[model samples]
Target: MNNKAFEVLQKEAPEVSEVWQQFLLKASALDEKTQNLVYLSVLSAFHLENRIPFHVKMAKMHGATRDEVISAVLVGLPALGNIVTTALSVAIEAFDKD
Candidate 1:
């Protein structure tokens, strides 16, 4: 929630950020935990390691276990290979936090 890009978007383009949040809410047909898990996989696939910790925490808040977080990070390994591994440590560190 304290991400710099998100802060900038909220400060400089509040309307766009609000609309994006609305879109996410409206488009979420999957259960929250599942959606967060899917988001983790996509983040991993894209090598979005910086974003992983936030989503990993969200996933944990939604009842995702540590193993689920690990699996989500590795889910993209087949298609993306080792690039997905870059997110594993980041995701685990986030998930393991209190």
Candidate 2:
């Protein structure tokens, strides 16, 4: 349900989780926003609805615009089908938060 999964994973496997975090933070060729967008696409494709808003907010913090996230969600179109149309609303609302 949210980042609770990631939190639990880190706590349960701190060493491995730290390594994976370092890999994403340092080993990735993509920028932060790009990585977040990629994560969004993958999560949406997998129908991981619970994680959507969390990643959407992270992407926005990493400099992804609303339009950019819209495009990312659409990239999962073949697998997501009509869900993309509605998921966009959640993503947009994440960015709209006060």
Candidate 3:
């Protein structure tokens, strides 16, 4: 449970965050809101709840509505409905937090 290591690394190399943003920016076909919604769906499908909040905020910032957020979270209904539902709750909490 040594979170400090990651904190230090990110502090020292904040450019990693920027690099990821830049990479994400390369997908020209999708606008920012759509991209964020896709990211939310992917994260939920992968059970990566930790990132749901960040993506939710970004989605809202990029014009995703609450209903759209819910829909995005439920993208893979047949295969991952349960997990995505949990992620939906997290997404809403995070959206409110933002």
Candidate 4:
């Protein structure tokens, strides 16, 4: 039988699973919209993860403007530097959607 995504994650790494749950709880402590914007910023960090589109959509749903999301991504550029930050261009492409 195919396990659900959550189940697979739990089995794969129980420690990570706990941290994930805790992260979600903290994110959810904010308003739904703010939470979504935060998630979008995170996904923007992992361009190849294929999670960018979903989180960008969620960010929009949460009332974040394109500028806000882009700014958030840009905020990481200093710390992540060019090499890592450039990878997040995929998020800009994703955000270009209608």
Best by TM-score: 1
Residue pair clashes in candidate 2: none
TM-score of each: 0.83, 0.75, 0.79, 0.59
Off by over 4 Å in 4: 1-27, 47-49
Which of the two, 1 or 3, has more lDDT?
Answer: 1
Q: What is the lDDT of candidate 3?
A: 0.81
Local distance difference test scores for all models: 0.88, 0.81, 0.81, 0.66
Flag regions of model 3 displaced more than 4 Å.
1-10
By summed lDDT, the worst window of 10 consecutive residues in model 1 runs over 1-10
Writing each residue's lDDT as its tens digit, candidate 1 over 1-98 gives: 44798989999999999999889968889888888999999988987788888888888999999999999899888888899898988998898887
Task: Give residue 74's error in model 3 in angstroms.
Answer: 0.7
Across 1-98, the per-residue lDDT of candidate 2 in tens digits comes to 35787889888999989998888789889888999999888876766767888888888988899889988988878865886666677777777883
Candidate 3 collision pairs = none
Query: Residue 44 error for model 3, in Å?
Result: 0.8
Give the number of the best model, judged by lDDT: 1
Off by over 4 Å in 2: 10-16, 78-80
Give each prediction's root-mean-square deviation over alpha carbons: 2.6, 2.7, 3.2, 6.1
lDDT, model 3, position 63: 91
Error of 1 at 89 (Å): 0.5
User: What TM value does model 1 have?
Assistant: 0.83
